[model samples]
Target chain A: MPIRVKLDERMREKGMSLTELADRVGLTLANLSILKTGKAKAVRFSTLEAICKALECKPGDLLDFDEE
Target chain B: MKQSSLSLRVLKLVLTVCWWGSVIMAVLVPLALVYAASSSGNPKSDWEFSYTGYASGIDTSSLSAVDRDGREGRVEFNEGTWVQVFYPIETSAGRVKLVLLIAVVSGVVLAFFLVFIKQLKDILDTVSEGDPFVEVNAGRVRLIGVLLIVGTFGQALLRLVVSGYADSSLRTTGFQLDGNFEMNFMQLIAGVSVLVLSEVFRLGTKMREEQELTV
Candidate 1:
């Protein structure tokens, strides 16, 4: 139930807006917003791959497990 | 965002109004019949009565007689006691039975309306609370379906009863039992609407479940 989506800090370091990342990854702004706000129930592996490819980061840098 | 909730609220209000309206009709119709029966000034008359062979053992002697117009009649039994029976001149017992049947059917419809609104409220509440995996009780839906079916058939039976009374020679002052073809049509439409709405709810619930699974 508790999954961490680390996005804002990485986006800032990469000098990217959510819109820019979503555009690069071919995802919707709504979906990117959901990921950024940690509101997604689960993220697909394909989506994770796309996000990583667009952000030039490993999955480890993007996702973390949190205590529920 | 709020529009859907507002629409549901409106629907709940409309359903409540319909439920109470039907209930009022259910009560008032019988009262009207009683009032009409009492206000008539025609004197009662006694007449010989016999049941057809189909209804053997029925005490036709005990059945009170009414005027040819269907007004209340006084009958003297073999015991030499005279009793006054209040019967409508234009309506038969079969017609009165149908009115009572309509009252019962209306009450049942009101009950079903209440239950459907309550379940709808529950579903809305669950959805509002963000419970994506909510399970709807299928039994409630089935109950609505059954009520609709019953109401349709009950309306048809009421129509038949009214037609029988209309064709009878009995006449009671201020009391008329007329068959309204429009009412029967409305009843049929209502039944179909309820059935369609129930199916829509079932489909919506199924889609929500599938969405949860896909998500």
Candidate 2:
């Protein structure tokens, strides 16, 4: 299973880096990297909300379900 | 950074030494006895004769006569033979007693060590279960140490008595005082080491408790 994360596209469109997003969301770079790479088993709702708010995007804009 | 407790480590060391020492003795004592028995020739053939009748019962009238010098004499039966009979001397009884004493003392020492090891393992288990504040009984360790010391000393004394008896009865009894003394000394040292390590473990437990309280 793969969770297609559009973090790279969102960050590019917003002219922000992963470090900047991690700082905004009060998360570590490693955790943010896991989420961006779709390596996370599941993201907490609070963490997802924080990421969406920091990215100024909807959850649908950040996540996509793809069979792997 | 969790390390094993000092008492537990010492207990393991003592048990290992005790087990190995017993194994070596069990092998060596029988070998020594076999070597001693084999070197003295065939004891069965040399010591199986029984004295029956004396030479006075022999009939001299029917025997052939042989004369030498100016005297004539009749030859009687001459079947005298020298045999060496090995018997359990008085000293062997004392040695048996000493061996019994050593066995009893070793049993007591082993029992004490077992109990101490079990108690130490229990304490370690409790610590591993995240109960650092659990009360440890130092008295148990102390009691076991005392018992071990007493048992070891008793074994040493018994060995000394056996050696003394052997010296008096068996003329060629080769007794090595060094080995027995060293074993006894090591046993004493191990007991004392356990006691000291238990004290150190108690201190470590107290420090851990204090840290937890401050946290």
Candidate 3:
């Protein structure tokens, strides 16, 4: 929970919709939404690789460590 | 997986049969008691019985009988005093009433056990499909553990009442016969153990849910 995902910001920066990103990454829209909302328990390396490739962003750009 | 499923199905079947059997027994005993009562005349004030103490008097010197209350009734060596275990006091029409009551109560207790088993069977149905650690199961197990504790206490109370009655019946109503209250320690421990396990299962279920939700 401390590892905050900045996926929404990065997605907005690229002007890419969730559905378009899901299709590009070959993941379901529901799972992509979970990632977008930072509700996912984990993001697999393969999934991260696909999402990073799709958004043309680095892992650090989309992930942030926010301490409580 | 297949074997476990098969065993579960068998267990379910056995529990169903036991439930129905106990229910049937509960129904039949009252009817039989009524029939016996009706056939025999009303309580005769002068009716008395001479009890035969054994199946046939085997030398009970080396043997002792334990009552439900954990009292040991044994034959004394030097005094020659015969502490007879619960032999049927007298086989009269009145005794039929006592037997009928006991039979019916036992059937009812069996029915309670049946209901508990049915709950277990339902939970096992979920486990057979490889989904064992559901939240409902934690509640069910806790319920069963509570039942066991409550049921044993209930049984102990019943024993007290019955034994108290036995002490008074057919003789002077005094503390002449031992009216010991039997508390089954094993049953109480089993109930408490199950309750503890239910809490553990509940914790496991919570952790599993949290892990699943964590993406």
Candidate 4:
């Protein structure tokens, strides 16, 4: 839970909608939304690779670690 | 995969039948008891039973019966004693009281069985639907285990109380019978086993949730 997904922040920075990102990454909108809302328990390496490639950013740019 | 195997279906059918049967009995038994107690022409007035002590206590040394080896030694219970007693319920008041006691005791025991069967049926429903790893199944299994353990102890307590009540009123000439309570180890072990299985299901449920949430 401490490893938070900054998908929404990165998406906003790139001015890309969730549907557009999901279509580019070949993932369903629901799954992409799950990641965006920080509800996903894990992000697969392939999924991370796809997201990083589509957004033109590193995995670190889409993820943050905050200790509660 | 869905668990629609023939054996599973048959077992589920049998359990459903048993649950309905128990439900019917739970309703009918008290009515029958009350009717029997109220009827003036009651068929039976006295109840008698003989039970041997659970442990070895009977003296078999004097018996001449031979064993498989053809020796004078026979099956020995050197410490076992068989106690036989006649319990009289001659009066209408006594009969009514007995009926009330039976109804209460049986109601509690039957309630336990009904809940256990219902929970089991629910689990089977989930399994049949190929969704057995839900968290509620773990809770239901845990409840069955707790019920089994508690029901065993409750049975022992009921036996003690009923026997003690019987012994207090019945007059005897030579020997007196006491209420003896014994723990049922088998049921306790079974309950513990189910509890362990519930924990395993809980782990499975957690793993399933994690798997589902992974993107």
Candidate 5:
């Protein structure tokens, strides 16, 4: 939970919608929604690679560690 | 792929029947006792507490046995073991006590059995639905395990109390009432096993949730 997902900010910067990113990354919209909403328990490396490649960004750009 | 299992369905049916049966018994047992007590005009000799007792002294010398050869012979006993005695309730108060004892014992047993069956049915329902990793199922299993352990010990204590009550009231010269109270290792083991299983379920639920939420 401390690892915050900045997917919304990254997606906004890329000018892409969740459905578009899901289609590009080969992920379901529901799963993308979970990541965007910071509810995902884990992000697989392959999924991260696909999302990063689709969005043309690093994993660090979409993820942040917030110390509680 | 949530394919329905026929065996699970049959087991659910059996559990349903058992649940209803326990429910019926919970309602009927005390009623039956009350009816028996009320209907018998002279209930003193009719009602009795059946208990096992140890008899002392040398009564085996006079004991006779009939073999299959139709020859009667004296039987020798090595050790004076337990003897089943149906001690009659001679007084109205005693009969009332006996009825109350029966009612309480049956109530406890049926109550535990009902809850146990209900919990089991709930777990089975989850299993049948192909979602046995739910967290609630773990709680249910834990509850059943605790119930089993508690019920076993509680029944033993109740038996002891009833036997003590009988011992205090029944003033027979030769018979000493034995409560037949013993620790049930099997039920305890079963309860502990279920508790362990509940832990396993907890872990499974956690793992499942983690897997589901992983993106």
Candidate 6:
């Protein structure tokens, strides 16, 4: 839960809307939003790969360790 | 298909049909019983639903025609008909009130059943949404376990009350206890198993959540 997904920042850096990123990564908007809100319990490697592929970022760029 | 696919199968439709059917029947059966009680015109100083028997001639010593008091049971032996009925001494109003109480109990049982059905429906909704594993479902499953445990005792109490109503008249003729008390462990174990299943769901949900975020 402490590992936050920096999806909002990455999407902004890529100048991509949440919906557009979801479409490009083959993920649902709700799930993407869950990640952005830090509500996601975990993430799949394939999903991270897709997001990275779509946003042109490394996993570390999209996820940050923060103390709860 | 994966194991999670089981929740998404046609079983959901089956559960929907059963839920509707049981809810309707649960409401209607109690209503009909109460209506019968109201119409029976018998003095209801006590509980009495109805009872039928075979026998002829009034056994005056049977304490019916003489000591007609607040006893309950539909027992009567006439000179002609080989049937008898008896009821405990209760005001008509008291009997109606008892019937209403029974109906209320039935409603409570139905409500619990409906809650259980709602849990099933929710899980099915998740399955349809392509996810059967969720943390909320663990709580729902635990609720079902508690219901089952409590339901066994509830059903037993209901049976006693219903039978008491029907046999209240027996005091006029005769009354006897046909069985000994027993505590059934099977229902208890079944209820406990459900609790275990809920724990399983909890673990499954945790794993699924982790997998979802593993990226």
Best by DockQ: 5
Ranking by lDDT: 5, 4, 3, 6, 2, 1
Every model's TM-score: 0.39, 0.33, 0.60, 0.81, 0.83, 0.54
| Model 4, position B74: C-alpha lDDT score | 57
Worst 10 residues of 4 chain A by lDDT: A1-10
User: Of 3 and 6, which scores higher on DockQ?
Assistant: 3
- Candidate 4, residues B27-103: lDDT per residue as tens digits? 89988986766782465646323332222244445567776887775565544243545455566676677677678
RMSD, candidate 4, Å = 3.8
Q: Which lDDT tens digits does candidate 1 get at residues B133-172?
A: 3336444554555666676777667655545454353442
Tens digits of lDDT, candidate 3, B1-215: 42375677788688778767767876786677667656555445233333211112335567788899999898543421222334433446556666566667677776787778777877877777788889999999998999989988987776666555555453422114434466788999999999999999999998897776644
Off by over 4 Å in 5: B1-3, B40-45, B49-59, B64-84, B163-181
DockQ-best of 2 and 6: 6
lDDT tens string, model 5, B1-215? 46477988799889999999888888788789988777545743466667644443445555788899999997765654555557666777777777887787677778778888989998887887788779999899899889988987986776666566555556555434544565688999998999998999899999999999999
Q: Which of candidates 5 and 6 reaches a greater TM-score?
A: 5
Candidate 4 chain B least-lDDT 10 residues: B47-56
In the order shown, the candidates' Cα RMSDs to the true structure are: 14.0, 22.7, 8.6, 3.8, 3.3, 11.4
Sorted on DockQ, best first, the list reads 5, 4, 3, 6, 1, 2
Looking at candidate 2, what is the lDDT of residue B31?
64
TM-score, cand. 5: 0.83
Tell me the tens digit of each residue's lDDT in model 3 across A1-68.
79889988988999999999999999888888888887887778898998899999899998999999
Per-residue lDDT over B16-124 for candidate 2, one digit per residue giving the tens place of the 0 to 100 score: 6665665566566556545544443533323222211111233456556556665657675464222222443234344445445545555555555556556655555
Better of 2 and 4 by lDDT: 4
- The global C-alpha lDDT for each of the candidates, from Candidate 1 onward, is 0.60, 0.60, 0.73, 0.80, 0.81, 0.71
Candidate 5 clash pair list = none
Interface RMSD of each: 4.3, 13.5, 2.4, 0.4, 0.3, 3.0
Comparing 2 with 5 on DockQ, the higher-scoring candidate is 5
Which has the higher TM-score value, candidate number 4 or candidate number 5? 5
Candidate 5 structure quality by residue, lDDT tens digits, A1-68: 79999989888998999999999999999999999999999999999999999989998998899999
